[model samples]
Target: MDFRFSPSDDAFRRDARAWLDAHPPAEATPRQWERTLGADGWIGLGWGRTPYGNRTATLTQQVVWAEEYARTPHTPPRLGHIGENLLAPTLLAHGTAAQKDQFLPPIARGEAIWCQGYSEPGAGSDLAAIRTTATRTTATRTTATRTPSARTTSPRTPATYRVTGQKIWTSHAHEADWCFVLARTEAGSHRHHGLSLLLVPMDQPDGSVEVRPIRQLTGTSEFNEVFFDGARAHPDHVVGGEGNGWRVAMDLLAAERGVSTLAQQIGFGEELERVLEEARDTADPLLRDRLVRQWAELRTMRWNALRTLGGGPDPAAPSVAKLLWGGWHQRLGELAMAVRGVAATAGPYDWTESEPYELDAAQRLFLFSRADTIYGGSDEIQRTIIAERVLGLPREARGQ
Candidate 1:
């Protein structure tokens, strides 16, 4: 990969830089930034003119935009990052034209927030074990708190699948407008064979969907538990066809690790740089070595991530990236806290066990990064992927 910007791309970069200078993202609210970005056609750079202000942009432009945007301060928190990063790409590659037309524009405009409905109490690391069911039926009801009654036909209403299951550690579920859910659509079907990926509306009139915020150690509620009780998805909403959700889910995961990760790695680079700047005056030899080692590891991760991009997607690439960054971030968090000495362990006197804990930057990093290894995919799961897919190892037996 050349990694050089074309002259036209440079001009584009200049324009973007000038816009950022004028906007100074920190001063505006997230929604306000979204409107400005969407109006200017910067939100979905590679996707084109429908959402953002541009038409059929090149991949180079996307890269340039990501690079420049990260360089600028007050870049609005990625408000609809899930929709733009994972879902849009998946829809482009596998969704029907109608699905694309319906979903993509909203994502581009930061209007549609999305959540993933994959992990369940029984199926966190082993996603193939998800027990959520979507039974086709004519009857519509909310609340799947009980086992769905067997199909009884009614001629009056259009048929829809009743989604009944629970998804835990669902990021942004509480605020999402929609969710892409993987459920068993085939009765008595097992493992990867009987699955379907359903795009479900979170704001159903039946009140079948429930989102409860999961308080984190950081005292934030970004993660949630989502319950689906007789929530409905039109049969037409299945992506990549019904009974092929396993494949669709895998493709979405691959998309999860695509070029967008370049921007993430860049963000990681900034975090690592901050660590270096903060610890510069400290003379502790052990701390100094850890910082240098972290820098080297970050460089290696950046290289690996970049290489995967040029070579195209692999089943294990995202796992490798996740494993790399997840562990790296956790360790960096520890180092950050270590540098803060005793203050890392202390909080404000008023902040007791009953009150919501307030955290400083280093304290927050140390606490929150603990989940880095567990949330995306556990470190064990990523290793299993690398062992089986990349190395051609025999598959591990899943207990029946």
Candidate 2:
């Protein structure tokens, strides 16, 4: 596919860059920043003209917007990305008209934050092995029925599903207003057969949903453990109908690696530049060679990503992108520490002080990047997908 941008695309890039420059991030919180973007019609660029008043941009323009946003310094990590990037695309593909109408407007307006409820303690990489369940139920109120000469009463109400289970590694669950949950909806069904994607509200008034932040090695708590005990979901909120969550979830995963990845690469490039600046005076040939290799690999990854941007049905594209970036990021972290020498091992803290300490950029990068190969999907799982699906190899044996 041709990678060249049209003049209009260049104009869009300039407009995006100017807007980003004019609106300095300053001290805006993540949610405030999201609204800021939405106010300027910067959010939901990929979505075409909708009744919700979202700006429509071409595919190239979307890429340009992502690149420009990443190039901006001190921009807060987007809290609305899961909703705008992942869930929005999935809804466009597999959600009902009502689902889209209900969810898409809030996302486009940056008024709603969403978390994904997919990974479980036992079903992280093997998503089909999920054990969470959504049992169908109904609420009813008495209605008078005229029979013979007397009035009789009957009860009836709308159908809803009671969700019950735990989801670990749920990113931003504590801050989310909603969660798209994958749970078993069929009785006695195994593996992928019985799953349903239910749009559940996170702010349950009855305390059915609970979120516990999981502190990480970097002393941050972006991921959380979410427990749903009898959480309610309306029947109308089911995406792609019931018992079809496996496909919808896969579609969302595919959406995860699109234009946003180019923005991610821009961030990676910035990190690499920081590492290079730290290593500028180093005389060690080995360290210099490693930095050059990293630079080269990042370029290659960008090209590979661009090559796959046409949205062809390449089964291995998403897995390939994941493996490339995951390992590359981990290595960059190691190199960051290497450039920092022994000083990277320590932080600014007083053990006697009641307050907690903070981690510098290098230390935090080194520590957090350790999970790069593990989260999202592990290296082992990615390789298995490429082997069995892309190369037509025999499937790995599993215990029944």
Instruction: Please provide TM-scores, in order, for all candidate models, with all chains considered together.
Output: 0.89, 0.94
Enumerate residue pairs that collide in model 2.
Answer: none
Q: State the lDDT of candidate 2 residue by residue for 105-180, as single tens digits.
A: 8898888999999999999998888999999986677689898889987767777899999999999899999999
Measured with C-alpha atoms, the lDDT of residue 129 in candidate 2 is 88
Best by TM-score: 2
What's the lDDT for candidate 2? 0.91
Q: Write the per-residue lDDT of candidate 1 for residues 1-400, one digit (tens) a residue.
A: 6656689989988987898888787767766676667666666666655533334567667766777887787575576777887788788778998898888877776677888999999899889999999999865544334347764544456789899999999887877889999999999898888999999999999899999998888888878999999999997889999999999898888777666767776777887777788888999999999998999998888778767766754777889889989999999899987777887798776744676557877777788899999987899999999998899999988876
Decoy 1 TM-score against native:
0.89
